[model samples]
Target: MKRPLLKIGELANLANVSQDTLRFYEKHGLMRPSARSEAGYRLYSAQDLQRIRFILSAKEVGFTLKEIEELLALEVTRDEKSCQDVKSLVDEKLATVTQRIHELQRIKKSLQSLSDACCGGDEPATHCTILEALSDHDAGSSLVGGKHHDLIK
Candidate 1:
């Protein structure tokens, strides 16, 4: 026999989320309890716990709630086309992460150059090369050999 449905508190404890967060998920259409008790308490199944775990996992992987919703929708359909769609979304996310990594690398190198320029011998702030580079309009262009906007944006 299957386990009986769990009330909100029980599900929250099992799922490791607060009852308010569960209600928030429900309000946001991310999830809903499987049923309600006669006294109007929310009730959930084991499947709901699984769904909450999936939601948390997706979030940890940097998926936006909107993206997670799309993933969940695709999962519910469980069709070949949906699998292809989900793969495409994953590819897009990977590309975005790659681009962000590249951007961060550029920023790191630029900041490193500024740090290198500073002698760090208790020089006055006015004479600090790091501060000078930050204040100067053409700093990144000279230090990193990239345009200012390239380093920052």
Candidate 2:
């Protein structure tokens, strides 16, 4: 039996992505239509739909387009070593996310300290400690791992 092919718009609706997104994926070499109709419309197969879903899932987890391309290549190979390589890629992403979390935590602490320093008064901006701290060169250093121990005081 012959497999069914879906038009570009149909596939986009099934995938819940814009038709332009599908075209972008094609341009990036991440996806390809199974065939083109006589009317020049792009047509995709069930396999293409599966590939697109995989790409979207990878992107949701912070994989770059380039990385998704690598993953697609790896998926085709389907060996034990390929599985190991995929694990390594996920590990690298996890480490990056972990580092970003730490940096954000530090920023949150700094912002909280700055907020606590403010008296919340509606009087005038001239006497606002928050504004003063923001203008301080030393306070700016806190964003780059510099000491902010005295920021609250």
Candidate 3:
């Protein structure tokens, strides 16, 4: 049975990505056209469609293009160790995400303390405690650590 080859536009439509996206993937060596028409149009096979889906799914899960490339390479050489390699990559990403969450939480707490210190008055900002704390180096350091609630008072 002959497999049907799809033009670039057709594949893009099926994959819900722009033609430029396909080109970019090609440029990045993440994907390749199965063949080219005599008219110079890029053509793809069903296997290409599956590969595009895999790329998109990995992206949705926060994998960078570099990481996705590693994953694709792993897929091509599957063995008993492949699962362990993938798990290690995911665990690294999870640790990074967890660290970022902690940093953001600390930032949020600092901002909340600054907001709570302010009276929200309509008066001029010349004597605002929030502004004053921001200008003071010691207070600013405390705010960054989220331990300056008492200092603001």
Candidate No. with top lDDT = 2
Model 3 lDDT on a 0 to 1 scale: 0.76
lDDT of every model, 2 decimals: 0.74, 0.77, 0.76
Question: Which ranges of candidate 3 are over 4 A from the true structure?
Answer: 75-153
Better of 2 and 3 by lDDT: 2
| Cα lDDT of model 3 by residue, 55-98, tens digit | 99878857798878876775423576677877787678678668
Candidate 2's C-alpha runs over 4 A off are 75-153
Task: Predict model 2's lDDT versus the native.
Answer: 0.77
lDDT of 3 at 91: 78
What is the per-residue lDDT of model 1 for residues 1-153, given as tens digits with 9 covering 90 to 100?
Answer: 989999989888987889998898899889998999899999899899999999988787577888778767754256876778778876886787786566556656546656655667354343345444443634445443343465544
Over 3-104, each residue of candidate 2 has an lDDT whose tens digit, in order, gives 889998999999999999999999989999989999989999999999999999878867799988976775424687677877887678677778767765
Sorted by lDDT, highest first, which candidate order results?
2, 3, 1
Top candidate by TM-score: 1
Better of 1 and 3 by lDDT: 3
